[model samples]
Target chain A: MGASSPDLIVHVDTFARVNMVYEVLSVISVIMLLAASLAVLITYNWRVCVLSLAVQYLAAFWLINLDYPLAMAAVKLVVGWMVCAMLGATPVDLKQPDEQLPGRLFRLLASAMVWILVFSIAPSVLQWVPTGMVILWGGLALIGMGLLQIGMTTFAPRIVVGLLTILSGFEILYSVLESSVLVVGLLAIVNLGMALAGSYLMTVSGGLEV
Target chain B: MNAPLIWIVFPVIVSVILFFLSARRYLVVGLATGSNLFFVLLGLLLPIDRLIKLGPWAFEVSSTLMVFGRKFVITDSDAHLVVFLYFFAAFWFFGAGVVRAHRLFIPIGQCMVAIAVAAISVEPFLYAGLLIEVAVLLSVPMLVPPGRRVGQGVLRYLIFQTLALPFVLYAGWVSAGVEANPANQRLLQQGVVLLGLGFAFWLAVFPFHSWVPILVGEAQPYVSGFLLSLLQTVVLLLMLGFLDSFAWLRDFSVLSQVLQLVGTIMVASAGIMAAFQRDVARLFGQAVILESGFALLALSVPGYQGAEVFAGFFAGRLLALALWALALSNLAADGISFGFDHLKGLLHRLPLTSIAVVLSVFSIAGLPLLASFPVRLMLFDRLIPEAVNAVIWVMIGCLGMLMGGIRTMMVVAHSQEGWRFEERLPPAILMAIGLLGLVIIGIFPRWIMPYLIQLLDPFQSLGVLMILPLI
Candidate 1:
């Protein structure tokens, strides 16, 4: 694609053959993404949260591949899993006696609302995004839930995870729009950097060390 | 050597070396200072795509470096950016040891600068968002050293800065579409909204500025000051690039008005907020925000003059912020609270440091015979007719920040401690240099103002109004 052509840069990968298995997988990926994000929102167990986060990257990878070349797309999955490993290595202490806890049911309801909002709005928003329905639903759900997670907590770990989730969602959307190697590399760096930063924060902030 | 190699790769390599010797404060500062000085010289002496002859042997430096199918290109017009960034880095690095900043300050700060350069040189501007994100991540460790608990301020800052990424990426796509067909009102609207949101979050323009003061309150003074100054300047530079790249976006009639309004709001709100802050460090943050507002207002001026005035603010802002941060570093060395009560009558104890703090504050407030006065005047001259109400609000904002300075001064002066200068010699000398630089710039704005204004010359359309009017 010419840089200043003033023409739309169509993606070659978007022309992939539509198969039933891939279609089923895409639907499963969106569902899995929603479940993973919801799990992250309400779960107190750091282990479960990390596992849900891992599942998120997995779902993200499945959908992102629809738009990006398989090899370039797998970079996200690798980086996301690596980020999970780094965070998992860090001991996270989520329990604070002095902090007031919002009821779990309230959290569940809030997340459910986020799911409904994103899933409902996905079709309307799809007019702008040039990707498949799988990407639209999965991306919106991750963004909404990521925002909810960020808004609901001040804890360093939770905030970091939320940021990562949001980034994953954004990458899914951006992959369809951009195919620049530099953009991909820089984003991968951002993900790894954020994870390192989060671990550093946890280490310094007195979170439990594994 | 190419621009990226000279500005980006060299800095990263040096930063890695600095990391190994980071524990040795003096050595790290010395190396960083010297290397940054080298970079400034390189920026001054080296011309991209032009041959240089030194002692008979000659070599031409290329502008573009290809890596992994991507181009990191810094053209000749961008050379001044190298000059500006490193000169300030050298200035701050020179004083790092005197202030007893964290050992990681030099190494991490250098890494951030390298990442900043990468953000600047990347081929497609959209790629910059992620590079900037990495830079923000690097700041976390520098701001919060070991044993220091992370505050909501840092987290908020992280999240807020991160939030700009997606909006900017999406906007890049929309803008591409708009460029293809500028007549698509719906596409244009979508582009404008996304772009505005991206910049708003990135710049922390009004109402979204809580993180600035809060982070200032929580982090070390020098670290926060350096990061804010660097990040804000780079973001502004990026915005200029956006405007320069998109004629459609620039011609969108409301862009100027929107900028002026946002700038006015940030200035007024920050000033009012500064007046109410009990903690002096938080006030410093508001001062930073006010400066950001001023830069935005400067950019809103009718023509290339606006860009010049915008660029002209750099030297003054850098000096003032460095002075302010360095002074605060000296004043808050005891690890004591930054509350007014704790700082009561501190003037008697640290006279030079106290004076440095006040002068820096007043300078940022656009006090006469200070660094910011001339550019502020240039902005007001053109801005008033267009935005009288905004100008009035800005003056009120200026007064509020001045009031903050006055309040701080009164408290520092009222202390009961016996009159004595307790500041160490090295830090006092650094503060003196900063103060002297500010005053010198203020007294003879003509000496430096023209050079600073030249920063916009590379952007052809933006530089069309290169002839600066006499202030």
Candidate 2:
């Protein structure tokens, strides 16, 4: 059970185990992030507001752990939490219909996660062992997550689905070690542009409570 | 100044200049269109690596412009292709000026020109996926109908493209190993599979083709034409670029087989779908999707002859689709219903639109002595010998498409009696262009083929050259 024990049944080395743990933590953090993103999207619920920021912080923590081992995981956590806290203090009820609330929240979360997958998760895949397999698995996971969110919600899921699909592509890009800095940078800009466009769409549709 | 850099920067600069001169609509249109024309001219005139540096930034005016880490490198082989992209963009910008809300037209038009320039200039084996994502994103606003269906086709398109990007990216990534001559055939296999998936998505091959019809249904006719015809032309070149630049891809028999299979399915399914399609826009979408598959299969076949045929065929498709989209959009704007029941007796009412549609359909159907004929013959001739089953599939599909065309004509012609002929006819210029282009290409296929062949000579190896005679 100890870190040095080769006798441990798992084939993973200490670093690998640490990476795996971080991966798990990353998944959990992503789930939380999705929840918070969902909440922020669904309604500016003051009661749930604190949870949203806390989740974003947790996501940053786990994501950072996948790389710079000593890198502070709490940076994103603290930042996300702070944003959430501010929102919680003065909750803005999107005040949209209750029936439509979940769908909106799901879509927003899906979009936010897509960005995270691109800027954060995808690049980190480069650091994993068996790089291609890891990248492939990561892409499949992101795709699965996106689909799950889309299937679970009825709102304008196209925007989120599109973004998620794009992230899945980023995952594949990393798997192939196509770490073309220029390409990644260009994709980043495109993703943000899409997010802006998607937001504009929701606003236009009367889906965004604000 | 670097040709590639100037080519890209000029558009952005022009767009900015035009954005400011919104008060003078015609002037802005003229400026934008003129600048786009200049890009086309530049694409034709510039050397592959013409570059201008402003401090740390390097600019090129071949295919794309690089600014502050932005690198646009159009190879000599890709010069003609880049020029074609700019030409199409210029054409669309001219059309944009005459329409209302030139806002969408200006920004997306400029962005598409940039994307095309980037697409053609970049090292094809390296950056196709990212370029595709950029193009798709740029297309979203245009593809989705305003305030309706909430970006249905755009979203589908985005997802399908996203699915495809990884495949091609991974293929390129794995093929990079070919430089080192990786010992593992498994690596090669993985790369081929990824590429197959990628091209299928990019081309809207069957089963992954839902986006095509949906996009046509939702998008404006003009924008749809740009995306399907001009954008697709560049995309075809990008795919061809992979084959030219990457020996691994050109040599992969398995990958070639997958393309053949995909093409066969696309042609058959699209034809079947079109026969049943009630919506005119969707019918166009299906036809285009099928044509795309045919083009993809043609290019994917392993040889110089196939690639050469693809280039000529693609140019023809570009012209055909552009004319078709213009005519369709004109009809849509005139409150012409696209449904079968609604289109009855339409031939008498709109002579020009009817002629354009008929001509375009003939070209698409690969009828004798039309633009698409030589391309189809080249594709089926090569592909049939390899996979007889695919040939049969395509032949059957061709029949379906033929019937679909007749069905469409019959319905539209029948609907003409009830409605009055108050609406003005579509511009005669576009019809003439479509008719002339197809007829000229059909009568003398070799006229354009030789030039395209010469332009693409750098891609032809001894092995590929050997296959040309065989094809």
Instruction: After the best TM-score superposition of candidate 2, give how far the Cα of residue B86 lies from its true spot, in angstroms.
Output: 1.2
Error of 2 at A103 (Å): 11
Residue range B226-317, candidate 1, lDDT tens digits: 99999998999888888888888888888899889989998998888877777778888999889999988988886787887888799888
lDDT of 1 at B359: 89
Query: Cα deviation in Å at residue B421, candidate 2?
Result: 6.0
TM-score of chain A of each: 0.86, 0.42
B248 Cα displacement, candidate 1 (Å): 0.9
Interface RMSD of 1: 2.8
- Model 1 stretches astray by more than 4 angstroms: A1-21, A96-102, A208-210, B416-418, B464-466
lDDT per residue as tens, model 2, B1-471? 555656665676776676677667777778877887887776666666567666999765444455445556666655665566667777777765543333565666677677677666665445757776776766666555356445467666766776676567667767777656866677777767677778777777777788788778777777777777766666676676677776766677667777777777888888778778887788889889878878767765776657766766765687677777777776776778667776767777776677677667767878878888877888777777678888888887777777778887777677425644543533556566668888888877877775555445445451343233222
TM-score of candidate 1 on Cα atoms, chains taken together: 0.95
Q: A1-210, model 1: which lDDT tens digit per residue?
A: 454433333333343334545866799999899889888887878888899999999999988888788998899999999999999998887754343365667878898898889878888888788667788888888998899999988888989999999999988888888887778888998999999999899888877421
On lDDT, the candidate that comes out on top is 1
